[model samples]
Structure formats: C-alpha cells, structure tokens
Target: MRAVVVRSFGGPEAVEVVDAEVPEPAARQVRIRVAAAALNPVDAGVRAGVFGGAGKQIGLGWDVAGVVDATGVATAWSPGDEVVALDYGMVKPLGSHAEYVVVDADAVAKAPATADAVHAATLPLNALTAAQALDLLELAPGRSLLVTGAAGGVGGYAVQLAAHRGVEVTGLARQDDAELVRALGARHVTEAAPGSVDAVLDAAVLGEPALAWVRDGGTYVGVIPQAAPAPVRGIRTTAVEVSPDGARLAELAALADEGVLTLRVAETYALDDAAKAHARLAEGGVRGRLVLVP
Candidate 1:
C-alpha cells in the first residue's frame, strides 16, 4: 500500500508519500480499502505542531470513508459495504492517509447512500464534533444560539441542526460567508462583532473577541481549546472535544439520508498528494471540508 509517511512533527512538507505495506484487520477490526478521507484543521494543525500529535509518526488524517474489503469477525457487513468512520481513537490508531486501514468494527457505520465517497468522508470528524457540541448545549427552542465560524464544517452543521430545532440561531463569519451561514439556518449572521447572546457555541477560534459575544451566565463551548474563557464574566465555558459514538454517527448518516443535512467540499485531491493537501489547508480560508480520494 502507498501511504503518506510522517517521520516527524512539523509541517505539510513532513508528509512523505511512499510505498508502504497494506494493513490487515485484527480481531474485531475491519480492513477498509479507503476510497476517500477528509482534510480537517486538526489534521493540518497536528502536522504543523500547532496541536500535540500524541506521538504519531505515521500519517495525519482522522476521517475515513471507504468500502469494507475484509473483516476479522463474521458480522452484518459483506466485502463491499460503503462506510464512514473515524480512526483517531484506536489504541494503536492507524492514520487514514493510506489505501487500506484497519479500524475497530464498532467504530464505523454504513455511509449514507445519499453521499458519494468524497462527501461521506467529510462526516466523521467534523460532523461528529457538531453533533457533540449541540448535544452539550441541550439546545432549547426560542433560546438564542450563536455559532461562531458558522461557515466552517462543524459550525455550519451546528447552525442548521440548531435551527431545525427552532432555536433562534445566529452565526459569526466573514461578510462573504454571511449568506452561506444564513442558508444553514442562522436567523442572524455577522462577521464577528461585539454582542451578547444566551449561549455561544464557538467553533471559531475567536480569541479575546469571544468575550464580546457571550452573555453573562450564558454557556459556551469551544472547538479550539487554545485560549481560556473568561468564566469570571459569568459565562460557563468548556471545550467540546468530540468523541466517536457509532450510534450517534449512525444517526448523523440517517439524517443525511433524509435530506436534513448537506456536505460541503472545498476541494478534492488525489491520495498521493497528501502533502499538498495539508499545505492547502495551511494557506487558510477553507470554506468547507476538504476531501482526499484514496
């Protein structure tokens, strides 16, 4: 198998695409012939040494979407069932930047038929983050919810899901993305200005500016765990680190199948150009999730 080998932590240039051995399934694991994977900020950030890589020396993608080619245990799946799954939490996690990946069968689910391989690949990490963030908010109808970085993958999904629940949704993004954010169900959209709200679900890495939008005693959730929140301002803030829940992921897929959600692809690159893929993410302003076709 050909894989992008990361020998050290630094930048995109560290991702070296080279010949590697194909991975096989272990007990309770399924080997996926990877068709696609998504480029997430976490992937690029980890490669850039912005976030701790957890001693990773292999590859750097967290999302995976592919077909099951083999399984260690006899289960409901056959040799060719399209699926989307996250490999980040595996004990000896295999990176998704390869032609084959062996992930625990319990960590994956069938990909929504409504989504093609590239789009299905976008769901695992980002969408799951959105689901977890919203779940933490315990969103209430008629309550105002502000989604920072609303045009990005996690934020975009949060806007729509929160709005679908009839919460008064607001989004923070650039002026260009205001309409796109609005389309995601934000009742109001802005490029980020000083304001207060009932609760702020900040997917945006809005540093000190975060203090402006969250009201006293309001709840706050952050995607970036970098800066500390000013809880002294009477705001309850916590970092929403998403975890892989197969059942919740299955629900997200079902929502996609029912047309309650949509996938956004900023671009798709071939598997071999994994370094270039991470480089593109570094240049910034990724309007949507980036997908890699393996």
Candidate 2:
C-alpha cells in the first residue's frame, strides 16, 4: 500500500508518499480501503514535531472515509460497508493517509449517504471535536453558546450541533464569514468579543483569553489539552480531546442525511501532492477542509 509519511518533523516538505506494507486489523478492528483522507491543523502540528519524537517518521491523517475490506474475528463490521472514522489518537504509528488503514470497529460509522467519500472524510474529526466540546458544556436548549473560530471545521460543526440541540449560538469569526456562519445556524456572527454567553467553545484554542467570553458561572470548553482557563467566580473550564465514537458519528451522519448538517470541501489533492495540501492549509483562511484522494 502507499501511504503519506512524515519523513521528519519540520515542515510540509517533510511529508512524502511511499510504498508501505498493508496493515492488517487486530482484535475488534477492521481494515478499510481508503477512498479519501482530510487534512486538519493537527497534521501540521504532527509534522512540526508536536507529537513526534526526534527524527520520528509516521503516517499522517485522522479523518477517513472508506469501505471495509476486512475485519478481525471480534469485529462487527463486515466487508463492503462504507465508513468514516477518526483513525488516530495519542499513539499513532500508522494512520489513514494511505491506500488502506485499520481502525477499531467501534470507532467506525457508516458514511453519510448524502455525501461521497471525499466530503464524508471531512466530518469525523471536526464533528467529533464539536460534539465532545458540546458534551462537556452540558448546555440546555435556549441557553446561549458562543463558538470561537466558528468558520473553521470544528467550530462550524459546533454551531450546527448546538443549534440542533436548540441552544442559541453566537459565532465568533471574521466579518467575511458571517453569512456562512449564520447559514450553519448561528443566531449571530461577528468579530466582537462575546458578552455574557452561557458557554464558550474555544475551537480556536485561544486558551485563557476565551474564558472572558463565558458568563461568570458559565462554562468554557477548549480544544487544547490542559490549556483551559483557571476557574473564576464559580465558572467551569474544560478542555476536550476528541475521541472516536461510532454511535455518535452515526448520529452526525444522520443529520447530514437529513439536511441538518452540510459538508464543505474546500479543495482536493491527490495523495502524492500532500505536501502542497499541507502548504495550502498552513496558509490558512481557506473555508472548509482540504481532502486527499488516495
């Protein structure tokens, strides 16, 4: 199989496509014939040595949409099942930026029927991040929720999901993105600092600064691990690390199929052009995500 590997921890140039042994599923795992993989900022983080050891080389990807090709005996997935998954965690050796990848069956969900593989590949990691962040806040319907980086992948989904739960959403993004944010169900979209929101989902990883957006006893959820702001005035601060949950992914897919959620594909790159894709993402401000057709 062919996989995109980070040859060294430095820059996009460090990423290269190489021939590699096809991985087999372990217990409770299933092998997927990958159709597409989506790029996230975490990929650049991994390339820049945030998650790698000195001189370490590893496959790079998390979001994947593909079809099951095989399954381990303990797995419930069967061959030919179309799926999407968050295919990596803290200990990534191999990942989904490859021709084939193996994932725990419990972490794979049927891909949204309304989307093709490339579009479906954009959902898992981002949507899961949004879902997990919202879970940590435990907001009730009609409560005000503010999402930072609301035009980006995770924050975009946060807006939609929060709205679906009947929570009022105020999206913090550039003025240019107001229309798209509002289309995604944000009741308000602006660059102004939040005022007295019940909760703040800091998808932008703004750290302590975002805490000011939450009301005095409200909640602040951050994406950066251990970077939540200190609690003040009885306010709660939580940081979330997105984890794979097939059941949750299935529900998200259902929303996509029902037209309650929309998938956005900003650009597509061939597997060999992953370096260029990384460069594009690093440039920033691209709406939606970049997909790699493997």
Candidate 3:
C-alpha cells in the first residue's frame, strides 16, 4: 500500500508518498479500499507539525469514501459495502490517504446514494464538524444564528443544516460569496456579521469578534477544539471536537441524497499528486474541497 505521510513535518514539501504495509482491521473495525480522500486544513496542520508528532512518520488525511474490503468480528459491514468514514486521528501510522486504510466499523456510514466517491469524500469531516458545532449551539427553530466563514467547508454545511432545522441563519463571508451563501439557505449574507444574534457558529475562528455578535446569554460555538473564546455577559461558549458517529453521518448522507445538502468539489488530484494538492490548498480561496483519487 502507498500512503501519504510526513517524516519530518515542515511545509507541503514535507508531505511524502511512501510504500507501506497494508493494515489489517482489528476487532469491531473494517478496512476500506481507498477510493477517494479529502485533503483538509487539518492535513496541512499535520504536515506542518502543528499537532506535534516529531521524529516519527505521521500519516495524513481524515475524510474517506470507499468500499469495505475486510471486516473484523461483531461488525455488520461486509466486504464490498460502499461507505464513507472519518479516520479520526491527528497522528497515526496510516490514514485514509493510503491505498488501504482501516477504521472502526462504528465510524463507517453508507455513502450518499446521489454522490460519487469524490463528492462523498468531502462529507465526513466538514459536515460532521458543522453538525456537531450546531449541536453545541442548541438553537431552536426561528432562533437567529450567525455563521462566520459561511462560504467555507464547515461553515457552508452549518448554514445549510441550521437553515434546514428552521433556524434563521445569517452567513458572514466574503462579499463575493454572498450569493453562494444565500443559495446555501442562509436568510442573509454579509462580509461582516451584525451584532446580537441568538447564537454564533464561528467556523472562521474569529474568536472574540464573532462571540460579540451573539447576544448576551446566547451561545457561541467554535469549530476548533479548545479554541473557543471565553463566555461573557452570561453567554455560553464551547468548541466542538468533532467525533465520528456513523448514525449521524447516515442522516447527513440521506440529506445529500434529498437535495437538502450540497457537495462541492473544488478540484480532484490523482493520489500521486497529493503534494501538489497541498500546495494548492496553501494558496487559499478554494471554494470547495480538494479530493485525492486513488
């Protein structure tokens, strides 16, 4: 098997594709024959040693869409089951970026019936992060909510999901992204958020500034783990450390099939060109995910 990893993390140049032994599934786990994987910002973080796995080979990639090729005991999945999964780890010996990757069966969900592997690859991480962050917000229908970076991956999903739940979503994004944000179901779109929403989902990591947009006694949820701003004026503050829930992912996949969710692919790179993909991700302004096809 060939996998993407960083032996001595630094920059995109540090990302390397190397030969590796095929990993076997452990109990309650399944091995996926890699079809497609999405390269996320966290992969960049891993490449740059942001998570700090020094003097060791750290595998990259978190989102995977593929077929189950092997399964461990007590798992319902069978070989040839098409699925999507979140390989939830910052540093591991292998990841979904490889030709074959193993993940817990509990983290695997049926792939969206309406999407191909490339599009499905974009769902697990971003959508899960957005959905989980909204869970922390706990806003009811008709409540006002603001989503910063509403045009980005997680923010885009947050806007759509919140809107579907009947929340009045206002998207904060680049001026040029206003149209797209509105198309994603946001009731309003702006380059800046107007203060005093019932809650704010800070997908952009704006921290205190975004927190201020929430009204007193409201909620503020950040996407990054442990990076949320402190609560003030009786407001609640927390960050979502996204976890894999196959059941929840199944619902999201169904939403995509029903047209309540949209999947966007900014570009696709052959697995061998992963380094090039990282370089492109570093350039920024990518509207959707960059997928790697194996």
Candidate 4:
C-alpha cells in the first residue's frame, strides 16, 4: 500500500508519499480501500507540527469514501460495500490518505448513490461539523440562525441544513459568494454579521469577534475548540467537536442523494501530489475543499 505521511512536521514540503503495509480491521472495525479523501485546513495544521504532530510520522486524512475491502467480526459492513466515513473516533497509525484505512464500523455510512468517490469524500468532516453545531443550538423551525464563513465547506453545509430544518438562515460571506450562499437556502447573505440572530454558528472561527452577532439569551455555536467567546447577557456559547456517527452520516448521505445537499470540489490531486494540494489549500479562496485520489 501507499500513503501520504508527514515525515517531519513543518510545511507542505514535509508531506511525502511512501510505501506502507496494508492495515487490517480489528473487532468492530472495517478496512476500506480508499478511493478519495478530502483535505482540510486541519490537515495543514497537523502537518505544521500543530496538534502534537501525532508525535511521529502521521498520515493526513479524515474524510474518506471508498469500498470495503474487509471487515471485523462485529462489523455490520460487508466486503464491496460503498461507504463514506469520518476517521475520527478510531485509533490508527495512518489516516485515510493511504490506499487503505481501518475505521470503526459505527463511524461509516453508505455513500450517496448519486455521488462519486470524490464528492462523497467531501461530506463527512464538514457536514458532520455543521450538523453537530446545529444540534447544539436546538433551535425550533421558525427561528433564525447565522452562519459565518457561509461559503466555506462547513458554513455552506450549515446554511443548507438549517434551512432544510425550516430555520431562517443568514450567512456571512465574501460579497462574491452571496448568490451561492443564497442558493444554499440562506435568506440573507452579507459580508458583515447581522446585529442579532436566534443563534450563531461560527464556521469561520470568528471566535470572540463573532459573539456580537447573537442575540442576548441566544445560543452561539463555534467550530474552533476552546476558542469561543465568553457568554454574555444570558447568551449561551458552545464549540462543536464533530464525532463520527454512522447513523448521522447515513442521514446526511440521504440528504445528498435527495439533492438537498450539494458538495463542491475545488481541486483533485493524485496521492503523490499531496504537498501541492496542501499548498493550494493554504493559498486560500478555494470554492470548496480539495480532494485526494488514492
């Protein structure tokens, strides 16, 4: 097998493709022959020695779409099952950047029948982040929610999901992304955050700067862990840490199949060109996330 690994944590140059032994599934785990994986800013952070560098050479991938090559005794999946997974609640030496990855059976769900490997790979991490953030708000159908960085991956999903739940959505994005965000179901799109909303989902990592956008006594959901602003005037603030849930992913995949969710891929790179992919992501203005084909 072959995988992209960070030989030494630093810049994109540190990422290298190397031969690796094929991994096997453990009890309650499934081994996937990865077809595609999504690249996130977190991958760059991890590559730059952030998040403790995984303490050694570490593979960089979390969102994957592939075919099941093998499964564990307790796993419900079968060989040849097409799946999309978030590799978050599992222990492993390498991530989905490899040709094969082993993940907990409970962390993967059937991929959208309407999507290919690349599109499906883009769903798990960002979609789960949006879904979990909305879950924290617990907002009722006629309420309003604001999504910062609304054109980005997580924010884009947040707007669509909130709208689908009948919540009025307002998205903060670049002036150029107004139409795109509006198409995703946001009722309003602006470069600046509104004065107040029933709740705010800070997908942009606006952190303390975004607190003013929420109404007093309302909820503020953030993506950046431990970086959300302090609650003020009865406002309740929480940061979301997305967890792998095959059931939730199944629901999301249904939405995608139903055309309620749309995914965009900014670029696709070969496995060996992982460094170039990271460099492009860092350059910014990427319409959506980059994908890696294994």
Quick one: ranking by lDDT, best first? Answer: 3, 4, 2, 1
C-alpha RMSD between model 4 and the true structure:
1.5
lDDT per residue as tens, model 4, 1-294: 999888677888888999999988999999999999999988887788767745577778999999999998988899999999999732235999989999999999999999999999999999999999999999999998889999999999999999999999999999899999999999988733545688899999888778787777988989977777898878898999889999999999999999899988999999989999998988899988899998
Each candidate structure's TM-score, on Cα atoms with residue i matched to residue i, is: 0.92, 0.97, 0.98, 0.97
lDDT of 1 by residue, 154-266 (tens): 99888888887888988988899988988888889873445557778888877556767767777788876545476747777777777766778888899888877778889
Candidate 4 TM-score versus the reference: 0.97
lDDT of each: 0.80, 0.89, 0.92, 0.90
Off by over 4 Å in 4: 89-92, 191-194
Ranked by TM-score, top first = 3, 2, 4, 1
RMSD of 3: 1.0
Best by TM-score: 3
| Candidate 3 CA-lDDT value | 0.92
Evaluation by TM-score, superior candidate among 2 and 3: 3
lDDT of 3 by residue, 1-294 (tens): 889999997888998999999998899999999999999999999899888889999888999999999999989999999999999999897888989999999999999999999999999999999999999888899999999999999999999999999999999999899999999999888633445699999999899888778777889999889888888988899999999999999999999999998999999999889999999999999999999998
* Model 2: residues with Cα > 4 Å off, grouped in runs: 191-195
- Taking all chains together, the TM-score of candidate 3 against the true structure is 0.98
Query: How high is the lDDT of residue 146 in model 1?
Result: 84
